[model samples]
Target chain A: MHRSYYTLIASLPHLPLHFELDRTPITRPRLNERLKLLEDADRDVIDQMSAFLVWDRQPLDRNDQEVIERYDNLMRTVSNPLVRALINTRINMRTIVSAVRRRKAGGSPPVGVGQWVDHIRRNWEHPEFRLAGRYAWIRPFQNLIDEGAAREAQRLLFSVNYRTWSRMAEHYAFSFEGLILYLARWEIIDRWTSQDANAGQQRFEKLISETLGEHANLY
Target chain B: MDESLLMILGWTGIYGATALGAVGSIIGCSRAGQAACGAMLDVESGYGRLVGLSALPSSQIIYGIVVTMTLRGNPLTAQSAPGLFAVGVLCGIALLFSAAFQGACCASAIHASKNKPEVFGLSAAPAAIVEGFAVFAFIFALVVAGGIPQ
Candidate 1:
């Protein structure tokens, strides 16, 4: 029984190369269909993304607030450590954006994210701070934030997260955990970057080259 | 000991080695085969490579058979009976473990290659290294058998 359970955990779902991400401005039906390929843990996160588009005045006053709540739910429940790290990096990116926006409005820091941002500020070198895969890029992200380049900071965060995924894939290639996490992360990025396939492909190739070159030195 | 007892002991040595080799092969093949079957679920092609790689542990049995044959001499006299028993049993024990561990290596290779088929050849390197130990035992047994008095 134990052996069977191990096999089940190691058996990842098939992800075809022809994922058809080129359909920019992906319609709801197309997005849902593509999402069916993900494991339950990842699917839940993407499925709840629609809740971010709350135009009506209800329990959530702003779409951004809904997004933050969804992110908190995702961070709390995600099973994969690699995925959790990537999610934390994204959350930190959001916090930076929020911090800049709040400062412009002469308001205070937001709730959960603001507290975590404060924690990172105090203990950036702590081992626990490394859990988010942000330790390597935190100062750079802060620099971008200081420059008022939120868009550039977001792009930098995404690239850093991509590097983390690459490193995990290299270190844990024998296990299914890395493969599943990588494919899921790639799917999310594919959605975001599908607007320009040529540029996306170039960026992906550059990331892969750089990652493999780095691994060559270690092994 | 009597001639009959000595003969029995000599024969036991040979048979014991053969039996242990069979046990090792069974274990090695079963483990590797199971991993190959599991790996087939993920890939589109290259099922043959995994199945072929799974057969690597069977070499241990070949080594065991050679050692068993080497221990068999004309006229199992009292003088040579103890030497036969020693060589057969020792080589059998070595081959048994070598094959078992080789099987584990092959299983890991199969599983690893399932996700990244490109690494199939590279992954088999560890299992091949394990088989080399069996070869060493095989050669030493043959050399030691020659030293036994007929």
Candidate 2:
């Protein structure tokens, strides 16, 4: 047994075990890929959270039904409605004029973002794109002023909403409030980048840029 | 203070201080432009009730120059009124330089404000305080020059 052990040890090469790929076929995407998904989800989260944060649930009018249907379809296709809505909204963020230009230039607009927004009325629908709409409506996270009595209530609601929504995702579980914390991070990052002009946002901006590839100039 | 000397002090200080302030105004203008870009980004979602976020500093430089020039000089001194003159020069120059520097600082504050747009109002307080010092200096110079025995 000792000789056998000695023979085994002697037979072993003076190299790392990792170098000898035992052909372990670990099937799946990588951690970075997962992270990228998370990052994309995060952008979606930001978009949906923003809609909730800054929009009112005024129902879509008669002319706006088509847009709403598309939005609903997009939202339903993804596992999480809020995340899906957020992602779709963010992905489609084009300036109103540019959106107009694109629409006119393209001749017949496709089933993408522009078609949905154009038909919506301001009273029933909330449009995030600034140059396209007359009014900008954002549903601030809390109904009551933070200075008033319901500060804790607001905080609790924020968390619960985020946690619940996040849990719906296959990998990450997030609630509404968790969504807020993520939003807060986004806001802080936005503020930091804005103020610290020298400190370039290679990571966050690059992620956003990639996410926005063709529509980079939308905002 | 002698009358001729008073004239020399008043005009010279007024000219020098105003000129220095004018130089500061130009520098401040450039800085304000940089600050404005960040401001534009921030104002994307926020309320911008106040109109002069970028142009405000340029106005300050103008105010400094005007304040310096408008000061009353001692009537009696044909000669250099050393006390009256020194006060005018020091105060004029002080206000001018300080205002200019404050303009640059204001631009920076505006830039800083882009991130935390909610606290843009906070920047005004510090800038106001600094402006107060310049105003104090200017007012003092005016008072001293006016009090000089012609």
Candidate 3:
């Protein structure tokens, strides 16, 4: 029987849409404290999910081979169908985006030892990789990628994820599934907010460096 | 239809009314109470209201008790056993389901109210409606019990 975590779920702050939030609703420490209420087995599942899903927890330099290996390992060990679906969805999105990025860079479609890679290779010439019907955002996402609008592309992806998680949360309210969806939505908001801030900071640094360079030329 | 068997079933009806009702209340209250406790951790005030809402399902048990008493008002006999069994078991089943569903409604209300306290009263409308069904069953059972031959 699935255990409902009413107390734990109720303790969580309401998370607004990723674009609507300038910052995360709950801080890391408080979120962790609330998560501590999960059963030991649940906590282990969540830990595994965090390792795979949480953006900050993943190293920036992981290569395709390592990511594929991790994905395979997760798929093999994670027995929960919902968790597996979540992981698969995220990895598939990443794979599609990576394929788009590589295509834009004039690279051939990757030949790899994974279902997603094989699908991408077969559909290399198709504009939406024949997935636009299933994922309505794919064509628009591809357009944004092709335009080199990285920020908008990222926002579109985050919004898609936000909406997906929101629907899942609604369907599984007051249960462990609801909690997982809540955390997933929280991560989207957190990632979007941090990325927005980082982009602003980068622009600021770029302007300052240009101004500094002009001053050096005058000297 | 043996007279003794009829008496046994009639007694079963009498006891089942209260037992089933109590079971429903137990389940309903437990579900709603857990939600209330969870909501308490999120909010600063209105703890009383949340706790009170959680107790809404407790009414089913009271309804069960009333039906059981009414069913017990007459001595069990072959003539009235079927009537008692029909009214008592049916009413108990109705009360059981109403209370269980009402608890779910209350939990949803608690969840909504915890986020936006302004909707607290409005959010309880569904649970109130569920209680209305239980009341209907309770009243009808009492009226029907009176008609059963003494």
On residues B3-64, what C-alpha lDDT tens digit does candidate 3 reach at each position? 89999889888877898898889888988998899888889999999999999999988999
In terms of docking quality, model 3 is: medium
Stretches off by above 4 angstroms in model 2 are A1-219, B1-10, B38-51, B59-73
User: Per-residue alpha-carbon lDDT of model 1 for B56-108, expressed as tens digits?
Assistant: 88988888787787676535788888888888888888888888878878878
Q: Order the candidates by lDDT, highest first — what do you get?
A: 3, 1, 2
Q: Which candidate number would show the highest TM-score if scored against the true structure?
A: 3
* Native contacts kept, each candidate: 0.05, 0.00, 0.62
TM-score of each: 0.51, 0.36, 0.88
* Tens digit of per-residue lDDT, candidate 3, span A1-219: 588887788778777645446567888888999899999999988998887776434633357787767877888888777778788788777777778877878988754334578878888999878878888988888888778897898889889988998977788868888888888888887787777776657667777778797673464
**C-alpha positional error of residue A5 in candidate 2 after TM-score superposition, expressed in Å:** 69
lDDT of each: 0.63, 0.44, 0.83
TM-score of 3: 0.88
Evaluated on the second chain alone, the candidates' TM-scores are 0.93, 0.70, 0.96
lDDT of 2 by residue, A1-219 (tens): 000111111111111112112221111132122223234544464455555433322221223345556556556555555455544443343223223333334533233344334443232222233333432212232223333434343343334333433343223212333333334333323332343433345555767889999787687
Error of 3 at B15 (Å): 1.9
By DockQ, the better pick of 1 and 2 is: 1
- Root-mean-square deviation of each candidate, in angstroms? 11.3, 24.7, 6.4
For residues B1-150, what per-residue lDDT tens digits would candidate 2 score against the true structure?
565665676576556556655665565555555445435533554425222554554554555565455544434245435654566467656765666656555664564455456777886666667777776776666566565555
Docking class of 1: incorrect
